[model samples]
Target: MTSHRNPAHSLNWHPDWSSGGDLTLLSSDEIAFSVPSRPILAVSPALRPGAGGLLPLPLSLRLVLYFLDLALYGQLDFLGPSDNYLTDVLSLAGWLDSLGATSLINLLLVSGRAQRWPLAVEFLLGARLRRTDLCREALNRFNDDGRWRDTVWQPPGTVSDFATLCPRALPLDLWSSVDRRFMWAWVVADVPDTPPSFGLGDKFLEIYQTP
Candidate 1:
């Protein structure tokens, strides 16, 4: 919890599924969120070379800590302001730290839409650039989602260096999911649009015709 804003605005909301919990989702203006799980880690800014962080906690050893009993006992109010300025940067950074640079670039674009630039830039610069089957799988699923429509595909200004990030490009496995949730970020950044000299355009065709 960032603990900087109103304590209630942070990850302080209790999920409404426990005892005395009403599983009613509020309109976007309300704060009752049904957010999915994100990764967990803590680190510093990337611009300052002296700032410190470590290799991410591997995905194989994933651990989720949700205290259902605690939420049930407290029954905390789920309502709060709709503004994302109340978003906890520290919490967002922790989640971003768990993903590689390739994925972080996409997430940063999403955060940029919410105006969480502090966390977005932090994740973008610090993220590791690696392409794995897992990343490909996740991207494939995103391509299938309604959110991937071109109208909403706005990535931030931070993804311009994708060519330098991964030079030896690999082809996408059309049969597999290929997690390209943030592919639009690269497009908006102009790195993958022209098929960079870096040799990694295998995913360009299918992702371009995502419909």
Candidate 2:
């Protein structure tokens, strides 16, 4: 009698698979048993094209792009202090973190540069700033300490306060929770005061009372 061979044996399977076809698909446990997953890919500025075209950028420009990418991806400490790059990097990092990138907030906290305190406060009241312990520690060092004037007490209070106080702190939609809350509180607290009438109120009303 002639026997038929199984087609499963002829099929190729990835290392991620158990045998072949969907019959022996890799399970979650099997995947965990395999090689460890690599870290998330970071976009490199070296891979980016310049104004001239798709060619290697200048060293200075490359450096700037690298830091900017890191800041965008919420990886700020990767940027070091060279040619005032740290200032720009920290500022950008803070801005990114303010926009809900918690990873950048953690990086900025560990980097230990208080120069970004204003942005940090903005993040504290708005962004999902992780590592609460670290964030509080950094705030204490940068704000609660004697550096309050330089960091916390800038011209405007929150984003709205900034807009009201400066008119250029941010765009209209950039209001923070603190800003809205403070404004609401101000409006609620500001009761209009009644002025003293110079003459009798009855006489004033008589001139136009339902005539």
Candidate 3:
């Protein structure tokens, strides 16, 4: 007796086409799994402005912005601690408040250590210093700490009088021993190392003597 073999089963299987593999063979569904159909979420853009992006303004300013926005449009409170500090934007807010655009007086007060002393002083003197009580308070604090000599070598008018009223908090001997150069350098250059007194003094003297 002769036996006949099925053509499909008799054929040899090869995986590579170049190696005589059949291209018509279909892969079993069990070998391949279905892919997910969920859509991808898009990212939102940043809202803050300036070199450091957002949060560059002091804490007080951020708080003021929050309350001001609430008072302005009867809109939902959106400003928060995470809000960015745009100085120009804040200045406009101040102007709007000045015109009674909002009920809340938007005053961004910055209170920090001596690290911000010079900048604070310049800001205060710019236009806000005309508000005498606030100016006096800031000056009094500086003089009371014996930091006036080091921080503000030649302070504006009446500042010297305030300094005289508040005797140096530290001992005279201690104050004398403390390197003036180092103190000035720390204030001006934000440097940590002690510098030469004569050199520092000469450099600062020009600034102090300037009209």
Candidate 4:
């Protein structure tokens, strides 16, 4: 169905999506986005239109349209290093159950692109996403990159406390798994066979302490 954009409705129409849109979606805030059916349907099979080729979803217009744009272009670099942006991307992907978007985000998180982010961000995102590999990668970075640890110790006072990074404390089981990985890394290191009491002990206690 063809949809017309009305500027008076405060409708922010995206140039690319507005051009080839067949499916019309209504956001919770009453914004209308005319997006192509092909790109969204290709990734989200469960997404369907109602009468008049319209679908109402409980999401902000930007949330819905941004996701569709990502699906349209299959771009991963759209993500920012901030936790909120990453969380929003993952939340939208999961809500839509779009495997393509989910995989794209996962790949982005695990790639060199994420390496520039604070290892704490990587670790927390990994834990939040329940991807063990990412947690391990962050821990591995901590072991390899002394600079990361130094930052954790002397956080420029601008960064958020590691303990306050994520909204919720990691589940006890996940914390235990990460703790085990840290212990394993220490075991395999060439240093004297002692615990992480050197410097990492305080960092771990400060950050990963389970509630």
What residue pairs are clashing in model 3? none
- Can you write out model 3's per-residue Cα lDDT over 99-185, one digit (the tens) per residue? 321122222222222233432332233213123344344444544566433332332224233223223322233233333322332
Error of 4 at 67 (Å): 15
Query: How would you encode candidate 4's per-residue C-alpha lDDT over 140-159 as one tens digit per residue?
Result: 77657543211112222221
Instruction: Give the Cα error of residue 97 in candidate 1, in Å.
Output: 13
Ranking by lDDT: 4, 2, 1, 3
The per-prediction CA RMSD against the true structure, in angstroms, equals: 17.9, 26.0, 27.8, 16.1
- Give candidate 1 misplaced runs (Cα > 4 Å): 1-6, 11-131, 148-211
TM-scores of all candidate predictions against the true structure = 0.22, 0.21, 0.23, 0.27
Residue 67 miss distance in model 1 (angstroms): 13
lDDT of 1 by residue, 1-211 (tens): 3222233322333222233322222332222223234221211122112221211322111111111111212212223232111122122234534566656555434322213222223322432233344345444445555343243234323333433233343333322222232443332222122222222222322222222
- Of 2 and 3, the candidate ahead on lDDT is 2
Give one digit per residue, the lDDT tens place, for model 2 in 1-211. 1121422111111122223222111332211112123111222322333322213433333333444333332233211112122333232232333344354444434433323443443333232333434434444454334322211112223555433432332234433323332222211111123221212222212221211
Clash totals for all candidate models: 12, 0, 0, 0
lDDT of 1 at 125: 40
By TM-score, the best candidate is 4
Better of 1 and 3 by TM-score: 3
Report the backbone clash tally of model 2.
0
Q: Relative to the true structure, how large is the alpha-carbon lDDT of every model?
A: 0.29, 0.29, 0.28, 0.36
